[model samples]
Target: MLYGSTYPRDIFAELNRLQRELEQSFDIEPSIRGIGRGGFPALNVGSTPQSVELYAFAPGLDPAKIEVNLERGVLTIAGERTDQPGTPAQQATVHLNERFHGRFKRVVSLPDDVDPDGVSAVYQNGVLHISVRRQQAAQPRRIDVH
Candidate 1:
């Protein structure tokens, strides 16, 4: 008589092998917050009763290079980091390089009550501060019965 393999043995072995491979290759992608070209800078956002504030720590950039736009209850900040601070030779010896340099854009969703018309931004001391006033219609009002 001819010798042959059993039914359950081959199937079980194959399934086990596949499980092992999947477990070995299992990896999770890192979650990125905010928007940017490569490495995004940290942003601090705060909201008050009458306005919303946003601060971004962006050094080596000018006020002209940055552009702010608000549309459809969304705020977008886009700018390019030009390498004009140091000489080419000086930049070659950077030890701990943590600064981000490139074209970057960050978009934030504004609240329905925010007034897009009264948005403003200012850059100072390597920080960009933005203030958005809330619309009058969105403010809570007390009503009295006549």
Candidate 2:
């Protein structure tokens, strides 16, 4: 129960708890695509005066499978990561698997100054690096005071 004025009344809280219990009791099966958490590639995004750069740390993914798109002030990366090669029977117990797998799509809203046509992408050493240059007019200009 939350403290302060934010907490709901005791009766309301009890009713909410009962609702959750009833939902769990139903035990509805989940869809195949909704079975687990979808993949979300970790990224390091930064920008300079001239360009915006984004680097996604995605190992074990083929560079050819990756796709990047910039449109309407949005940058999107969508792709699928193939499964590891090996006989499933040969593998014993699994432990500590934190890496993301399956389909991944990340959309980032770009600044108004970013030039969509000037976007470039490079995949190397399991890292996807993207650079988008700023428009000529969008760059800072120095003015002379006479």
Alpha carbon lDDT at 33, candidate 1: 31
The runs of at least 3 residues in candidate 2 whose Cα sits more than 4 Å from the true structure, single-residue gaps closed, are 1-39, 87-90, 138-146
User: Candidate 1 — which residues are off by over 4 angstroms?
Assistant: 1-39, 85-96, 138-146
Candidate that scores best on TM-score = 2
| Cα RMSD for candidates in order | 16.1, 11.2
Give the per-residue Cα lDDT of candidate 2 at 146: 100
Q: Write the per-residue lDDT of candidate 1 for residues 27-107, one digit (tens) a residue.
A: 321122334322244578899988999998888787898989999998878776754667543667543333445556678
lDDT of each: 0.69, 0.68
Can you give the lDDT of residue 105 in candidate 1? Answer: 65
